[model samples]
Target: MSIRTNVINLTEFRNARTGPPKRSEPESGLMLGKGLTDQTMIDLIKKFSNPVSERDYRNRALLNLMYLTALRAKEIVSLKFSDLFLAPSGETLISYTKKGGKLAFAVIAEETLFFIREYHSTFEGDHAYFFLSLPRGNQKERSNLSTRGLQLIVNSWNVKTCSNKLIHPHSLRHTAASKLMDLAGSIAVQKLLNHSSPNTSSLFYTKPYFNASKFISWE
Candidate 1:
């Protein structure tokens, strides 16, 4: 069994102690903490999840899938065994329903695909939803996992890794957008993320920092 305890929200605590600001100001267009590196994320996942236990195996798969696919918590919990697809071109497709009530798919990493398979093997219950909670304290067994449960899972990992930072499952989405924006243009990241507006990707998701010295020549 994993550690069961309270998690302190350092950000909220600091904000509360500081009290209200002197004046209201316009919010910044850029979202900070959107650049959690892949290594850091994977490290936290590895640290928290033990492959020997079925629960940790499921958590490992969930965390890996969240990082690799950049899916929302609701979308992740809504997934099912049928969502996995082996394309004729040898690509693995992970399908889920988006918040906007649209069908969406993400091309998952090979490692993540393997984790999903492993999770399924160890997962108890013949539930339709891919993720489920082990029967606990008179709660009826269900096919689907709740969004709140997913939030707690992410929160637990966040607390374990960095008690001061406000990283959660949604942070993975932001990180994915930031990383993809650097590698593939914003349009590509936008499409992958299923954002209707390019402005959302540019203004909210992508980090605005860049080194001018690398691209610009000053003689």
Candidate 2:
């Protein structure tokens, strides 16, 4: 279950507080929480893979692309062939609708491009959707994966990989935002994530600043 779900019982907590929740001071000498490294992400991709056939491979590719692009699962499910473009510098561009139906573009890795090509060639469905669903009994159509289906895929992979970290499809979006903040600082992350306000961006970018007084000498 998500930590957000366990925060408070909405029915019991009716009163709104004027002040924000209190935060604890960080330990003077503890290592900070680390974001998932690129190597760690690569391992996660491999861990989610199945040896049985190419179907799992396609799913993994979709997951990777979603993470790499920092796209919401709905945006991913809504993607089409025309939404992808190859830049002159060999980068793959993933274009999709943002909040408010605004157009946004994210640069994808070369491997994601290759996998997308493979999926397109291997897919047997006539649907215009990028990620085609496996036919269900009496469904008689290839449909786009639902948001719930995307969550199930993430949950299943998390279980199979023995990763207890509460990683949802949205976690990838958070992961990308966190990494961007770590790499380029808050301003850049704010722009990339398309946050309307710096305050909103700060929620993801700001961390507990560690302080130690032992090193200082008073004159």
Best by lDDT: 1
Question: Can you give the TM-score per candidate against the true fold?
Answer: 0.72, 0.66
lDDT of 2 by residue, 1-219 (tens): 676665665434643643456686543211123334456667777865652344676676787787677778788778777777988887777788888889887787887777766666664545566676666876756677787877877766552211336556766776676677667776776666767875566665565563467677686
Provide the lowest-lDDT 10-residue window in model 1.
1-10
Q: How many clashing pairs does model 1 include?
A: 0
Which runs in model 1 stand beyond 4 Å of their true positions?
1-29, 34-39, 48-50, 123-125, 137-142, 159-164, 212-219
- The residue pairs found clashing in candidate 2 are none
Candidate 2 — what's its lDDT? Answer: 0.66
In model 1, which residue pairs have backbone atoms overlapping below 3 Å?
none
lDDT of 2 at 206: 63
